[model samples]
Target: MSQDLFKEINHAVLDLQGAQLQTYERPLKRLVSLLQHPDLETYNAELTEGLDLETFLEESARTGGSMVGSQRLLWPDSAEECLGLTFLLLQKMGEDPAYAATFAHDFYYSGSKIIAGIHSLTGQLIIPFIRDYKSYTQSKGSALVALQDVRSRKVFIVHGHDEGAREMVARFLEKIDFEPVILHEQANQGRTVIEKVEKHGDVGFAVVLLTPDDEGSVKGGNLQTRPRQNVLLELGYFIGRLSRDRVCTLKRGELEIPSDFAGVVWEDMDAAGGWKQSLARELNAAGYSIDWNVVMR
Candidate 1:
């Protein structure tokens, strides 16, 4: 039974990747609707039966709503373990289809013990499959609904004097269906540059272009290529405001970044093998649900 279930899940994931969602929707809907099977409810009951619901709820509060604590409290007996494993597998498949094969393989070989170990340690396996069903319904248009905000589609582009690099980045962004908010192209009116940036705070992420615009020295040593002061200033501002993960620095050539930013990852526009893929990864990490198969093609 577990092997059959795993085969069904594997096929669904492959279908989802290749299915042209714009022209056809039945396959995706059918896959998502599978989560609503009455068997899932029975499985859920098997895991939760004989558990003290009241005590679990109270302990959940005390433990800052830790799912591990809740799971331990509602520990499934040996007979109910397979049901719990199925529940967890469904959750993982919903979150990332790429992991479906790995999960299925582990389940086929090790059975429920693997899931039991995961449940006891990490609390992330708590999300029910029903939530994923709703996400699929909402993501029918562009998958942007999975992100839950229209404003998250906007990416602010910060650049130095390199109009060529900036334009290339902007065009790539457009191709991916992201709205690139270039400061120079926006209506600034009487507001200062800082005010302009502040007004456009709805941006989901930022890309700073570190072009070789100026020659600067660190501790009055040998001169080195660097981006404009304003570009660096905005980069710092975005890092502080939007978090370091939401900000990506793309350098054109040999550029000198501050020593304080030694650990921050930056992509080289020319040498980086696939800047588009890197940018897509950062945007996805920042909570934007992009269909890379469609966008990259």
Candidate 2:
């Protein structure tokens, strides 16, 4: 089973109390029923015959203990503690499955002492984490789903060192009303990374920079080889998963397209005004609605 799903369900359950308990009753019962079904015997396990709830409630207090009131928090930072709680819950269910069904409905009523012992014995982190699939489905909306079903629209750009290329891409995107998540902007650390991975890992195209040639080095003079290498790897991943046509390769000067991408359609960008007009025209032809005037503006 997915460990993450176990953690999520566990953390949510540990927060049960008063109104929270009341709110989760139906779901809890359903979960209990799923876990207790005799035929689905793989998940059967129990760390303790009766959970030590008191110590768990005490450790979960707002002021002390390793987790320190994580059970009661919500969102952002709460997501981690929620993971910990889920971890413990799964552990308990795995210790012994026989008693699982009998305690399903009664787990909520178990006092703090019983909860604490269970938490302690089960490492205070194990959980039968189950993911809520509907949450992700609803957030993206049906339009995205429809778009995914139709002709798969993807974006690919040849990255150039000319700072104008970045600005040009941004401007053209605005004109087309297309919000392309640029790699430079999304490569940051922390929560930003996670969000980017979740949202744009499947982007259809890339904006690559083309540099003027130089004979002195392996990369030549203007060839920004490193960035292209990274983009190529990304393209390969996309092409392997999606299709070759999804990647739109563009360039600035007389640089030869990489042997791997030689067959991809290439467009020339104006050195004087950057690639604004040329890119807009090409993207528009590809069925992406792009406003040349707005991009120029």
For model 2 the local lDDT of residue 204 reads 35
Per-residue alpha-carbon lDDT of model 2 for 1-297, expressed as tens digits? 444443444444432211122243433443444444443242232212234443554454433335322233121243323433443454445454333322331332122333322322222112212332222223332212211211223453434355667676666665566656565655555556335444565553444445443222244455332334444565555555434323444565665445776656655666565556656554433234445667777
Scored against the true structure, residue 189 in model 1 reaches a CA lDDT of 87
Q: Estimate each model's TM-score.
A: 0.53, 0.37
Locate the minimum summed-lDDT window of 10 residues in model 2: 142-151
RMSD of each: 15.3, 21.4
Q: Compared with the true structure, what per-residue lDDT tens digits does model 1 show for residues 158-262?
A: 999999889988998888889999998889789999999898856767999989999989696999888899998899888877666568888888878888778
Instruction: Output the worst ten-in-a-row residue range by lDDT, candidate 1.
Output: 119-128
Each model's lDDT: 0.57, 0.41
Off by over 4 Å in 2: 1-161, 187-199, 212-227, 272-278, 291-297
**What is the TM-score of candidate 2?**
0.37
